[model samples]
Target: MRLVATPFQRRPAPAFAIAVFLAITAFANPASAATPTQTQPRASVMTVAAHSQIDTRISGLHTRLQITAAQEELWQKVAQVMRDNAGTMDSLRQARTSQANNMSAVDDLKSYGQIADAHADGIRKLTPAFQALYDSMSDVQKKNADLIFQTDHHHAAKKG
Candidate 1:
């Protein structure tokens, strides 16, 4: 006599009831996928806050470097480009989130690579804006602007 796997064995009434419930649920709600909007509200708020921080930092640089009206006008043009490319920033964040979840040995490495590449791509996409701003700067002010706008360490250096 052939024997089946335990999973294929005769289920008790309670087990059958659970299976039927699951089947009905699967059919009643066929779509399992969720839209990006369905993500946590706090997460969305955090993203908006992050973008606002970037805006504030840029404004701080404008003040620190004493940008001219002409430069301010030019910066507005650069700002428009940054806003247009904002989706790239979101993509980078999503890539990092994906990396955080992938736990398998090889998956971890691949996810890490993807996250890093997204960062690099984001920088590449933002290069034009940087160059535009740089070109608008005077030779003496260029170094100062870079120093003030060094976002990597800006928040850390803030004491309170």
Candidate 2:
């Protein structure tokens, strides 16, 4: 007998799902391999809300890390990196999805590798900005930041 892992489970996640700096990852659920359900084709109609009922704010990050005014600039850089990483991962995932039917085993793995490569690229860009922000934090703030990143309990909980 053989066990087969789902694509989402098999693919590398650190640089991909962790949302650049892991903030979005912290706030949201990781995507799954389950086919999305659609009642209509091609998203024929979409609604834009002036104010989302669901709070998508990462202001919780500022609260959690107790970011001071002095730290806001550095924090913004970290936030931007997270957004950029998410965009890159989304593009890679969409490309993989588009080609899913015709992909050979090697092609599938290579496509997954593209995501891993992008993740590594994201981290390389993320590290310096994060390090700078981390450096300027007070001891208490640093401890909180360390706790958030080290365990990433929220992401873990979702996976389980």
Scored by TM-score, the top model is: 2
How close to the true structure is residue 74 of candidate 2, measured as C-alpha lDDT? 92
lDDT of each: 0.41, 0.53
Query: Measured by TM-score, how close is model 2 to the native structure?
Result: 0.66
**lDDT tens digits by residue: candidate 2, 1-160:** 4344444444433321446344222111112332223111121121122011011324556677888899999988876665555554554544455556666666665555555555666678789988998999989889998898666655554553
* Candidate 1 global TM-score: 0.51
Which stretch of 10 consecutive residues in model 1 shows the poorest summed lDDT?
21-30
Model 1 misplaced stretches (Cα beyond 4 Å): 1-46, 80-87, 94-102, 149-160
lDDT of 1 at 34: 27
Q: Which ten residues in a row have the lowest lDDT in candidate 2?
A: 46-55
Best by lDDT: 2
